[model samples]
Target: MNFNQFKEKYQKFEVEEFPNKVTYSPLVSVLVQTYNHENYIRECLDSILYQKTDFDFEILLGEDYSTDTTREICKDYAEKNPENIRLFLHHPDNKIIINGVSTGNFNAFYNFYKAQGKYIAFCEGDDRWRDPFKLQKHINSFKTNFRLVMNYHSYITVDHNSNLFQTYQMKLQPIGNISGTQLLEGKFHPLLSTTCFKKVFNEIPLEMTQVMNVDTFLISLLGNFGDAIYLKNIFPSAYRIHKGGMWSLKEKKQKYLSKILTFTKLEEFYLSQGNKRLSQFYRDKKANTFKMAAVFYFLNLNFFQFIQNVWNYIKTKFFNLKFL
Candidate 1:
């Protein structure tokens, strides 16, 4: 669909007309999702609270009932910055557990319903926004490029284990547009902390709620509507790599399997949406995932698992595997 068609489809959500003098609503809504991030949540909140934007914005945080003092810390900040920070929507200490898996994203979904901004930005509890003018920059970029539905920048990676740090960007080239195909195939994605997107869609898709990489799914879904922007070298946020981090903490085998499953779901989604090109890319991604997982198992001397993967690979290669 063209830009006009996209606007007609998704941008029909009732919103206050943009005032010529900039006085209607907060230009953005900052979303912070936390779970046992007691050590780092304060920094995340501070980064947003101290941002030097002229426009008003709300800090919408959801603490998934940390076993530690994460919720209490957020409470303190809410009390201190009542005007800017909305009351934290938190889960109980005993979070929802379905079939032994944690299902505590209710607060995240809740934030979407409660958000009242033209644009929404994301920063996990463990990540911090480094640039105070991040929001301002994004707002300006959107103003200049009305075709862009999403704008994101590179980020800094802090490795707690190695005590090393470095800036990360998708490509060595200068800032440019990110294709919907790339986002759909899981080829590249902007870090959640560094992303800001227009609130064009009416509601989250049911398929999206079932994915592990919520941020990736969202950007790809948005990509379906319009193009996205990427800032090459500019660092707007810091993504900490720690032992307890969500996806980073998972075992290599588990992580690979998760990616395999996610890609399968994504492929199915794209096919259902009549996106054959992206769906084919997802098939390739899933095949590569299986190959990588097989290699890992072989390296670990897990012969049985390795053989199982080999058969799966052969099935996918020659005989159309129906793993899903």
Candidate 2:
């Protein structure tokens, strides 16, 4: 996608006045993007709606067309909570839901531009916050520390059934400053739902749309604005792992393939930003995916794929060629 064209098209992604009549600035904007998450979307929305905060916050439910009842559910929530929920639906009668449409740019494009708050919090349909005070606490931290423009906390890992499997324990006190690299490779980078950052943005960076998993660069981009903090005092969010989720792949080779795609995009992204040093870091990271993919393919006796990945790895690692 031409980012220049994207900028021109959506630079003025007009924040139309809410039909429910909202004038006062909200304290936070909760972004929830979903597709066929009928089982979990309610819990996710409830978790945010139940949050105890003195200030008002709006939920931007970017309802990507879902074949199931996801859009209906979002429509219901928006109607019931007209003052709180804003439904951005891709279809009128779920045609887009059945057939599907290009969601890469618009799903996140609207989420970023349509926000009307000082802070932004993310909660996908499958993720939920453990603490009702999550927003209040993060807002307090931001208010207290002028330097901290970004804040993220820990989260627990849960199965699809909401069964807790492991805890991401971060025992240290709140950190005052964190770097972009540290945020990417740190012990607790945080799930999207676990972060509450100030809504300070100039333009939508090209990287957000170019990659599938924008997790690595999102915090880094936010970190560019100001130092970030990782909180350990509060309750962590619950990140559910299941078959439907994008990140969870049953096969080892598939996992490596996904990682390879993300890391390669990251390398290209870093290169686009003119950070050759970090670009090289992602380049090295991409090698592991290639190596792992090669091993998996060879063991599975997929000779062609194995040889292909091996050649890919050699070119990337030794030749230092930019994939983009």
Candidate 3:
């Protein structure tokens, strides 16, 4: 289905939109997906609002019925900065559930549908951009190179107290352009907060709703359109690791399970699309991830789990070998 068809199918589950006062078309749409992020939402909004750009942009804030004051805070920001922020109040019933788990896919997908800019940038409610010129820098790269579909920069990992813990760059030396296959092979992993991409596709694949990490799926999907540029000069964004963080707060076992599931679904998705190479690649990755999980269990001295994961790894490896 095309984007218009996708909107037609899912638009009825629409969130309440608070219109912004921006008259001209925005060059970029900043997608901010928030849920129970009252503590960090202000800093996240402020970071985007503080960006110094010659061109206009709009913030597509998807507040997914937070039990905390996140929704109220987002409302206040929308009312105050009517020209820059368009707030969408989402319903809990509209959330996408996979394997009995509710996900932010619905909120994120709705924001993508409503995005009206040439480019869409992502910064979750818990993450903040460190550079005021981030948008300007990304837009400049996009304008200069039409073949570039995505761009990302380095980022700093912050603890719950917002103190910097570690800084991450994609590589030791910058590569000008990275292909889609390279992205899928785990050559570079772009954090959602530090990434921006061209608005190329109207319809998202149905398999996307089944995954745990939408950001990873999205980066790989966009790479199919064009090359991704890595910016070395820009100041890194901040990715907060808090108790409330979705991925950060998960247990090691849970994180490994999520990755295993993600890889399995991605493999299936590529197979359905008739991309045998990518399907086989993900199959190999899935088996390797299982091996890693087994190693983790062994080192943690969880003998039962270690044995189970090792058995799973053996099964997956043998399955792949049969296919080969």
**Which candidate number has the best lDDT?**
3
Global fold similarity of model 1 (TM-score): 0.80
Give per-residue CA lDDT, model 1, range 28-87, as digits (tens): 888887888888888889988888887888877777667889878988887777667765
lDDT of each: 0.69, 0.71, 0.81
TM-score of each predicted structure versus truth? 0.80, 0.80, 0.86
Poorest lDDT segment (10 consecutive residues) of candidate 1:
14-23
- How do these models rank on lDDT, best leading? 3, 2, 1
Q: Lowest-scoring 10 consecutive residues by lDDT in candidate 3? A: 166-175
Model 3 lDDT on a 0 to 1 scale: 0.81
- Please say which candidate is ahead in lDDT: 1 or 3: 3
Error of 2 at 85 (Å): 1.1
Residues 1-324, candidate 2: write the lDDT tens digits.
Answer: 344566464444423322454435787989888888899999999998999998999888887678899888988888888888877775433221101223434565666677789899999888888899988999989988887767888777778889877533333423345764465443235556677888778466665555545665576566656768777776878887753433332456555655676677767777888988777887887886788888878977889988988988998889967652
